[model samples]
Structure formats: structure tokens, C-alpha cells
Target: MASIHILLLFLSCTSFVYRCDGACAEPESDTQAVVGRGFKLGCLSCKRRSEVKATATVEWYFKAKGEVDFVQIYTYTEMGPTIENEHFLDRLDWNGSKRSNDIQDASIYILNVTLNDTGTYRCFFNRILNYDNYEYTTVVSKVVYLTVVEKATRGTASIVSEVMMYVTIIGLQVWLLIEMIYCYRKISAAGEEALREAANAEYLAIASESKDNCAGAQVGE
Candidate 1:
């Protein structure tokens, strides 16, 4: 819950930062789960950005693979979350902020997840604010790409394959860190060389001027 609030603070700043880097501000995350198990879909809204605030609402929708339209499954607002979808029935759990009315974490844990759940889930956070008689809205949304599988094989071969994949990922991360350090050092060295060259050129120009003045004075004398 503490982490959720921290994340909200970070995301709220991006809302007003302009659209140039909006893509990075809100990145779609993916989650994998096995069938007949429970999975949580994470979502958070302004819930309330400022103390002098307005109303906040959250909605979750689902779109199966190859589908164009999304269906609403859950919603939360001042009235609290109401599982509106008949399909989810009694399997939906509000495992989010304790305050149901104004929820910070709209994350929902779905019980007995099935293969049909494989697809994209969208979480919408709508905030209506009225400051100084001017009403405005700040909306924050997130996409969760859920991949549900019947079963994940855990045989000897599978174990080896998983281990190798993990190793590859770790190796790539290490390589990237090393590359960043090398690049930083190289750039610093180049900057130092440029400064040295500029200083040496300035000194030479001053020396030339001094010699020319002395020669002229001697001639005059």
C-alpha cells in the first residue's frame, strides 16, 4: 500500500509534464498466471491529488484476444467498487486500498482464473476536480496484458531451459551496466581534451600578441 501511494506520486507528476514523454510516463505492464489460480490486476487513480479535491473513480475492463471491444468487469468510486460483470460473479476481490470509497490501489485479485482470461485488461482512473469554481478532470489509465496458461511444464528439460533464459537476462543486464560506465568515462575524457586544447590555443594567442608588442617597441626605440 505504501508503494502504491509512492507510485501515484510519480505518475501524478507526469500528468502535467506534457505529451512529449507521456509514453514513458505510463508504460503498459504484463503479468503471467496459470489457469485455475488467482491473479491480481493492478490499477490506481488520482483517488485524490490535492486536499482541496473532487471525486475519483476507477473502472476495469477486459478484452479477449482478437476482440475489438472491451467489457467492464469492476468499478470503484464514492459508492465503492461494484463487480458489475456477471462472468466474474463471486470471484472478484478488492485487494486494494482499505478505504473502498476513495481507493488508491484499484488492483483486483481474480480467483479461479481461466484460459479465457488471456488478453488485455484496462484500468481507468477518472478524477474530477473543482478548484476556484473551475471544474476539470485528470484521468490516469493503465493496461495490463495478462497471459494465462493451462499449465507450465516443470520437467528437467524445462528447468534447464528456464535457468538458461534467466542467465541470459542477467548477462544482458550486466553488459548494459558495463557499457554505460565505459561511455560515461569516454565522454568525460573527450570533454577534458577539448578544454585543454582551447586553453592552449588561448595561451598561444596571448604570447604572440606580447611578442609582437615587444618587437614594435624595440623598433620604435
Candidate 2:
């Protein structure tokens, strides 16, 4: 009876240890969003086993049209350039610089976002190494989508005022584009004119010297 009890106690302790080794599994965040007019994308969560003494690498993936093969939007490792997708080359940035094994709450900032920024994003945490040659674990958060809408100002107004505001904003944008093109053309034209004037001056000097030489030859003859 004493031997049987000892064996049971050993089994119980082994099970407890196995459970506590990786008991704090990372939790995923729900779908979050921000106002389309504001300069914000959303916050994401990433975490790993608390007891594991390993660095975590975070990566963000994005997909349009709900496709399975998502493209990599951003990647953060130990040391290197933060890899970004071609589409978001200049718009996306890490919101903060906080890192840990249990949980990482990182936000992303997007500037001057348009309708094309709307899509599904997934945050991932990959363990850097495994204990005693154990396989590394990867945890993924739920997909989040961004919805952008036109901003409404001055309370709820009549349809005419709303339409006028949109039209005015679009018109201003078009005018600015036209002005830029005009300025570029003017600068190019001035540069060409300067080159033409310099060439004409060189030719005039050569012609004047040739005329003086011809007059001198006639006098000698």
C-alpha cells in the first residue's frame, strides 16, 4: 500500500509541472478600428510563454479580399531594418517600444490614410528559441479590419451643405495639383531659357572675332 501511494503522488506532481510550464498562454485581441479621418490604425497584442527565457519576434501580415495567403506588412526582429510591405512603405510605423515574453501591446500609426488602407491585419509572435531543443511556438491574433468614413462637421446639417463641403474639399485638392504642375513647368522653361542664352553669347563672341580678322586681312591686301 505504501508503494502504490508513492507512485500516485509522483504522477500527480508530474502533471502539475507540465501544466505550469506553459500555463500563461497569450490572449488575442478583438477587432479594433479608428476613425478614418484620424491618424490612427489600431492597437495589437502579442505574447509568449512567461517562464520561457527567449526573445520574441513580432510580425504583422495584411490581406485584401479575405485571401488566405497574406502578405507581410511589417517585421521586427533582434536587429535590422524593419521590413515593410511595398504598399505601406512610408505610412506605417511602430507606435511604441515595449517588449516582453508574456505580453506585448504594440500600436501602429498610419498617416494620411485613404480608402485603400482598409483591410484585415494579423499580429504574430514567434519564439526565438526552444528549451532543450523543443520546437518553438507561434501565436497569432484575430483578424482586424479598418473602416474609413468621411468626417462630418457642424452637427447634422441638410443635404445641400454636406454635398457642398465634399465638393469644396475635392475642388481644393484639384487646384493644388494643377498649381504644382504649373510651377514645375515654369521652372523647367526658365532652365531651358538660361541654356539657350549662354549658347547664343558664345556664338556672338566667335562671330565678332571672325569679322575683325576679315577686316584686318582686307586692309593688308
Which candidate comes out best when scored by TM-score?
A: 1
C-alpha TM-scores of all predictions: 0.52, 0.44
RMSD from true fold, candidate 2: 26.6
Candidate 1 residue lDDT tens string, 35-100:
998987877553434465566678889899889999999987776669988888898888766754
Give the top-scoring candidate (lDDT). 1
Q: Give the alpha carbon lDDT tens digit for every residue of 1-221 in model 2.
A: 44467689999999999888854333343332344543544444434444555665667887764566788888766562275787778777766345544335445676666666667777675555457767566664646675544553343445778899999999989987887788788889999999999999999999999999999999999
**Collision pairs in model 1:** none
Model 2 whole-model lDDT (C-alpha atoms):
0.65
Candidate 2, which segments miss by more than 4 Å at Cα? Answer: 1-49, 65-69, 96-103, 129-135, 152-221
**Residue 95 lDDT (model 2):** 61
Query: Runs in model 1 with CA error above 4 Å?
Result: 1-30, 46-52, 152-221
lDDT for each of the candidates?
0.78, 0.65
